[model samples]
Target: MEYGYYPGCSLIGSAHRLNSTTKKIFKRFGHDLKEIPDWHCCGAFEYGNKNELTDFSKSNLKKAHGFCNDIVAPCPACYKNLKEANQDDGGSFSILHPLDVFEYFDIVESIDIKHDLEGRLFTPYYGCVLLRPKETAIKNKDIMENFITRFGGDVDGEKVKDRCCGGNQFFINRWATEKLSRLIIDNTHGDLVVFCPLCHMALKTFSENRKVIYFNDLLLYVMGETDKL
Candidate 1:
């Protein structure tokens, strides 16, 4: 499968690990992630209302329209933006999460990461999108736990998986974000694992003593393609 990837701002800088690990894992699965050339920020936080006119919003929509293929994203913010971009541009292309792509191959037994999470404790945190009503079809939370199981890792299934970590909003809204992060971190028995780079960053910032990782990072670790940092 091929997808037009959007590596949003954060992944290019603080979240570079997401891009590297994502490319490695997707390539291992025989999926091509072609990036859209000259792509810019999708306005990270929120988009203006329809009546409001702005080049950032228009450019974002236009770039998404130009892709004309399935859009895949590793960042939760990127996923939210890409999908919203398509909607803003009249649903020009199908937007898919990399997790969906991973599930597709796993269900067919086409690709398997050579690793396990058994006996290792970690919490899988899904930002707003995973908990929202729209992603119900992907079976987001349960499937994530299942993926951990595939790698022989003991995922603490009892932890709260859908809490908001405030993400980049942490700097802007420290109190709310910190409160949310503390609730999840304290409730989770050990470290945390996440699909979104922003969530990974937020969790790491929230608790330095605790370990936090991206899902793709775990895949690379199990594949023996890289060593623990």
Candidate 2:
């Protein structure tokens, strides 16, 4: 299936790893992540200028509809914005997070046997944007846990799953944000597997021992894309 792929500002900029790895995994599974033409940023959580986030998202949503009804957003913030646009603008389209796309397509059955995670710990860190407000959250909230179990990783991320990572406030007061992020990180000694790049950044910035990784990077490791993993 060729779905409209929207790479929000973070993905194209600091979160490129998530974008690249997400596209690679989908491509490996034979699903096309067709980027929507002339797509604008999701505008993150900033608002006030209703037109900036809403109008821009609706604009992208319209173009994505022209591409296809199914839209794949790697970033949770982008997914929420796009989904909101579809609903608020009366567009008939399914906005799916990459994790939802994984559930939609049985890529696990298609790929060859890959290296197992071998009991590695994957903290399914949702941060904040992925599963809040109920409206934009994906249908399968257990997706991260399910995927981790599918690859032999232990489910140890729940302790800090719902904890806030101080988000963009990390830049405002570095010490306080670090305190918040460290509390979340210190709870789990294993790597933090997150869907949002902002979450990834917050946890990683203060983490000392534990490696923070995007869900897509974990997929790449088990898929043999790189031996480094």
Candidate 3:
């Protein structure tokens, strides 16, 4: 089952670790990610106009659709934008988040756990783009819980799980982003597992002595692929 992949610009730039770790962890799960050729930005949160965003998202979707009907977007912004594009175009294809892949194919149980993180609490943060606007959200919001429990971890299940991390305003207003990040930090406890690169940056920049790790990197850590994360 080969799926077209869109790594988005962030993954290759500041979030390079996410790109490498996503590939490494997914390969370990016996799946493959064929990156979309001539891929462009999904417009991300840059252009909010409905028409502008649709065009930006559709460009990548069309390219990936040439490769496969099911496209996997590792970045949350890419996932949301791609999902919205598919919907606007008569729902012609599938847009799957990386976490969605783990659950949809039912692959989590198949991976052997190399280490048990007993009593280590983990907070699953979806940020704004990943699970808002219900129509574009992932099918199973609770899908991440299984991995944590199975891998021997505690989940905080914070009510602010879907709160906005103010990524859209990061450049325009640093104070606003910090305020949002502080709100999330005040509500949730334990290490953070974020799917979006911007969320990681927002939380890491404002958090005090807290581990804000990318979801893929955390998977790599629990799998014993690295000596220290």
Residue 150 CA displacement from its true place in model 1, Å: 2.0
Tens-place lDDT per residue, model 3, 1-229, is 6778788999989999888998897788777789889988888877758898889888887787658888888888888889888888888888888888878777667666677668889888887777788988887887666777788899884688888989778899999999999999888888988888999999999999989988776677677897565
The residue ranges of model 2 lying beyond 4 angstroms of the native Cα positions read none
Ordering by lDDT: 3, 2, 1
Give the Å shift of residue 4 in candidate 2: 0.8
Cα lDDT of model 1 by residue, 36-131, tens digit: 878777675665653343345347556756564777777766676666656666776777777877776664254344554557876777767655
Tens digits of per-residue lDDT, candidate 2, 1-229, equal 7877888888888998888898888888878888898998778777778677798898887777657888888887888888898889875998888887777775555546467787677788887777886988887778778877887879785767888898768778888889889888877767788888888888888888788888777777778886655
TM-score per candidate: 0.84, 0.93, 0.94
- Inter-residue clash pairs, candidate 2: none
- Which residue pairs come into collision in candidate 3? none
Residue 201 Cα positional deviation in candidate 3, in Å, after optimal superposition: 0.4
Ranking by TM-score: 3, 2, 1
Judged by lDDT relative to the true structure, which candidate is superior, 2 or 3?
A: 3
Per-residue error at 31 for model 2, in Å? Answer: 0.8
- Candidate 1: the clashing residue pairs are 116-151, 116-152, 117-151, 117-152, 117-153, 117-154, 118-152, 118-153, 118-154, 119-154
